[model samples]
Target chain A: MTALPMEAEILTRREESPGLFTLHLRLTDSAAQQAYRFRPGQFNMLYLYGVGEVPISIVSDPREARHIGHTIRAVGRVTRGLERLRPGDRLGLRGPFGNGWPLGDCEQRDVIVVTGGLGCAPVTGAVQYLMRRRERFGHVNIVQGVKHADDLLWREQYECWDRMPDTTVLIAADEAGPLWPWHVGRVTDLFDRLRFDPAQAIVLCCGPEGMMLAVAEQLQERGIAAERIWLSLERNMQCGIGLCGHCQLGPKFVCRDGPVFSWREIAPLLRVRGR
Target chain B: MATDCTLVAELRFLAAADRQRLIEALREAGYAVHGPRVQEGVIRYAPVERIEDLPRGWRDIQEPGRYRLRQTDENRLFAWAAPAASLKPLVFPPREILFHARRDADGRLRFEAADGAAPKLAVLGVRACDLAGLYLQDRHFLQGAHPDEAYRRRRRKLFLVAVHCAHPADTCFCAATGDGPVARYGFDLAISELEEGWLLEARSHAGQEILDALPTRAAGETQRKAAEAAFRQAAAAQRRRLPGGDLPARLGGRLDAELWQAVGRRCLACGNCTAVCPSCFCHAHVEETPLTGARTTRLRQWDSCFTAGHSLLHGRPVREDTASRYRQWLTHKLSGWHEQYGRSGCSGCGRCITWCPEGIDITAEAAAIAGEEA
Candidate 1:
């Protein structure tokens, strides 16, 4: 016979933004274990039978596990299958597979995080890592963008970030709103607002390919060699142990080598087409 | 010229009447016998009760996606290439167990092994190309780093009765892959059926043991000669021939070529090409939860590369376009697989072409590569 889902019930689910949601799964796996053991940016392949399985990045921290969480967007069959689920229901699971962000590497440099739209999921882990140990790093600046005010993933967090001392949050949207305050242009135009020493600060950028390309290019222009910039690559990753050969942008197995890479590491191998 | 192999055990031929006698001897020896019998216009393998169940004077012709049998005046056996269904499902069941589990009343969890004891299978009629396929799959699921233990258990316990091909079909590409038209390995007994009687040669002790128990006599040189002639005729009948020894290497180099897009335009990406093929062994897993809400993770199902989820991510599919997906499948088949597995994944079983809704021929694609070079 099958066992129960767990003792803890879901607190609530919040729509962070379009294609991104925060599901506060009740920590029924174990209560003593506050947070499930997960590294930053590691993904869970959520399974829903009658529909199938789809992988979503775990945006929560290992230190905080009141409920399991993910920023999921509806896309294909399985994700669409999941979007239809109401508050309380059984969810199947396969893994927290693949390598997450390097927790050990974040301590030394002042962090410059740039994210847009759904790309915020992976960055949230790094954000939680930094916020928990704010003094370990130097200054922290987060530059984020979306299509509109509604596209902003975490408005509360952004407001919280705007309040923090030594933290400069540059928020932008693609099109201007009559009441929209901070900025009213593509996030790429906000490059003038960023402080770049290149050596002192490590830049990590994630978002749509177009924005990633633009930010990465902007960083390269700032005397930050491609090696200094880390770009999260997207590929179709199934069976995160590198068994399924799904996401091969080239010879690299994105599931194994990275969903993250230094631009210099992949730049030569990456043959970008003319824009 | 060498007339026999070190593994070959010579045995006597049974007259037409002694067929039942030998069958009875085998039944007494505790074997579940299976052999070919004609039904519904084709030759099919069924559990035989007596020697009479064997298809006599039965011959088959295989075309793309179809198989048919015809009666001949001469009662020759081993007159077909191979069966429509592969031995792949027999060794590696369509769905089989990875692990079983129960969530205890205390809310604790326990896991159990699902696959039971392996049965001793007496496989009566696997062809040469099919054996090569088994050999190939053995490298994938059996001999690989992550060995499929359940498959290994079943394989080690089986009794193979290898039947040589006396007729090749249009889809047979065994000649190119060096796999065959006849049984090559793990066979207890190899039978090259002749018009007068079967040329019985035991390749292992189990086959000899079975022979010793049966009421049988020694086969003469004339009987063996007739069998060889028939075997040659089988090889001659094939219509498709995969060209060159460098296929594994050649196919590897062209993975990124735009030719894949060309092929994609025609492919439905249904994965039926791999499904019916004798050599393809990709699989998926599922866990069944009872009303009690405990889960049992089952490694019990077939999953094809054609599955969107197999290569999708972030609700964004990796092979978002059917064209790239097509490219990946063919590239893996012809080239990329050799990098990881040391051989092309194809077994020259033309079922992929025949069963294809588009009838996309790999031979034509291979020729296309060769043509571009010349």
Candidate 2:
């Protein structure tokens, strides 16, 4: 509950793309490391020694509580500084905060994960969870879209998922490059080719607000209930708890109430600009 | 929490001249006394060691964007409705270091939290509206699943002395909010000022002990009546009011109202109103690193929705314009607060109205959105 930072050492580091990197960290304190547990969509306040903190979604599987992995894009001041750290470098960590993706609710239903831009990181853990317990769930569909083909990461992982039974992976790029294998269009365009029973499908979406809104609208048009559609939101989450008041969407503090919320819960506020 | 009627019935009279004894008693009991005093033509909370430190014979005239202090021949203390600031600064400080991250010789980084112990504070001359604001702050910082450690440490050591507001100002509207003119509860001692003396009552066990130490007598029927009349007069003098009953729901339905754009044009987004607000609790984190590069401290300072950075996401503001920012502040205070804290965030103390550089009256704005006049 305390906002104070816990020391964490970077166990491993990987460059996923030109600007995107992944850091696998382990809490220096054995007790804290052993006690730590997180869900797919929950985020941690990652602090670089002399820099500041930023809310980064955990991308590693929840079952492996030993080391946590976060896929981060070097965009802002904090993340850019975090990108420079090596495997042995130390940083401050404070979370496992915000509500995560509703993996439990999708046990017997088909799960559709729609992501745009660099939004696939938060749901990567959920997809892995479903893959591990493939018998517990029905069909698993993941749709991702990026500005350019060069912007996409984890190409091998996507190819591997596409080969699995009862699992479907579709990727799109707005400005397609040479030898691009996926579709060349917006994420919403994927729905025209998508096949599923709306009544048995649970859609989870993340990305830019416009993309999420479009995704939700397309799902609604396909007869998906708003209650069955969830989204991971983004805001200025300085405090992982609700105290900072920066991540408010009307009455909901996105950090406390959700990074993941049903479309039914945020539909009223999402459309209202500046809410 | 409302004051018990039975507790008020047992009121004791403390003469106007004997008020210094109460301050002395609190000081002797290991409390640092802070009370209202005239500073720079405005009433502010400051250190008080003697009765003379209180703003006696000074009446504050408050209006939209204006606050003036006038001295009269009258000797009554606490003639003003409210001070420029609330007791929030004493508990939840405007800026505080959350923790310090330091690197040792072994290249190990360590985080140490700021000191948790706080001085025992006895704050006098608390008005009912401010008390209500503090109550909401209590629920916000202390009643949640993750209670704020710094705020909790300071709050537990506070000994409050409530002063009933006998003279409500033009901007006052605590009565409409059902908060006060008379002090209700949440104080160690409640005092109702009268022409001759003060009617004092103890609401807590510590307050009873403090009352027992002071030389006091049973209040005469006439004195009690005079105090009750003062309370009534204060309530009746308030000219500003907000539409009562289910304001949260009502404000929710008015999200698209055109009033927001109209007010946004005038709003400078200077954030003065929020700085003076008793109940607003938005803060932003900052990092401070010394030139020595030995340690960096993470501090939090008071922040407002009016600031673009408060809602920033990847260097872009979620609330891009003043209209939306204004709506966010207003709706969150009057509407979203109900969902988060189970009540309206505003205590109706009128500090925001009086301190706003543009003279943006919240009561009038709320009423306008409700299709009513100011």
Top model by TM-score, which number? 2
Instruction: List candidate 2 stretches off by more than 4 Å.
Output: B1-7
Residue lDDT tens for model 2, A164-215:
8888888999999779999999988888766677898999899999999999
Fraction of real interface contacts that model 2 preserves: 0.76
- Which clashing pairs does model 2 show? none
State the lDDT of candidate 1 residue by residue for B40-100, as single tens digits.
6666566778766777666766665566677787776556666666677777777776656
Across residues B157-178, which tens digit of lDDT does each residue of candidate 2 receive? 9999999888888888898788
Candidate 2 chain B, poorest ten consecutive residues by summed lDDT:
B1-10
> Against the true structure, whose lDDT is highest?
2
Docking class for candidate 2: medium
The C-alpha RMSD of each candidate to the native structure, in angstroms, is 6.3, 1.8
